[model samples]
Target: MMYISELMTGAPTNERCPLERRMYETLDKLKIPYERVDNDPAASMEECAEVDKVLGTEIRKNVFLCNQKKTTFFLLVMPANKSFDTAAFSKKLGVSHMSFAPPEKMLKHLGTTPGSASVAGLLVDEDDYVQVIVDKEVAESEWFGCNPGINTSHLKFKTQDLLQKFLPKIHHRARIVDL
Candidate 1:
């Protein structure tokens, strides 16, 4: 059985990776209240369902993508259950030939590896290199759930806090796309 800790408010008491710690620090700095849980690394959306139960909200699916030239990078957050259609996403966004960004780029830009990417990663994107694309459904949801830059830990907070406070404070605006 998957091990999931009880729903707890705020950051972990013990040491965490720099990225994860930064996530909590940023949120706390912004006064954006959140709930979190520590669990085994969940590599897939299906596995996140268990964490969702504890969080009381579905975890959003965060994908790091780039254009063909890799010049234009994006961090897209969509409904966890929604399938990602790259072609359709590209069409909707008016970008061409969008593909999953390489792991190195994901690390360099988002500060997280595959299966561990989240909007929290945007806190490290100080240069505003990664364009944040949030699905309409996700943006409208009352609560947002995502990893704190690691799959082993997850966080849930008010969607308003993310859209209105977090992104703006980080100087990254969310481009809400219907997909």
Candidate 2:
């Protein structure tokens, strides 16, 4: 069974990765109160179902994608249950040849590995190179859920805080998409 820790307020007291630490620091600085749970790495949506049940919010499916030329990168946040239609996403963004970005590029751009990609990684995107696209459904949710920067932990906070505070603090904005 996947071990999901009890609900905790704010960030963890134990040591964490720089990216994870920074995520909490940024949230603290912004006064964005959140609830979190530490768990065995839940990399896939299926693995996250338990975490979601514990947190009382569905964790968003975060995907890192890139254009064929590799000049542009995008971090898409959508419902965990929603399937990603590459062709539809490409058409919606008017970008061609969209495909999942490689792990190395994900690290370079989002400061995360393949299964750990989250909007929180935007903190390391100092250059604002990665464009964040959020699904309309996720954008309208009362609470937003995602990992800090790793797959072993998950967080939930007011969606407003994410849109009005967190993204702005990271110097990025989410472009809402129906997909």
Best by lDDT: 2
- Per-residue lDDT of candidate 2, residues 45-138 (tens digit): 9999999999999999998999999889999999999988999999999999999998989999889898899987898899999999999999
TM-score for each predicted model, relative to the true structure: 0.98, 0.98
Off by over 4 Å in 1: none
- Write model 1 residue lDDT over 1-179, tens digit each, in one string: 88999989977889899999999999999999999999998989999999999999999999899999999999999998899899999998889999999999999998888999998888878998899999999999899999999999999999999999999999999998888
Worst 10 residues of 2 by lDDT: 170-179
lDDT of each: 0.92, 0.93
Give the CA lDDT, 0 to 100, for residue 145 in model 2: 96
* Number of clashing residue pairs, candidate 1: 0
Model 2 root mean square deviation, Cα atoms: 0.6
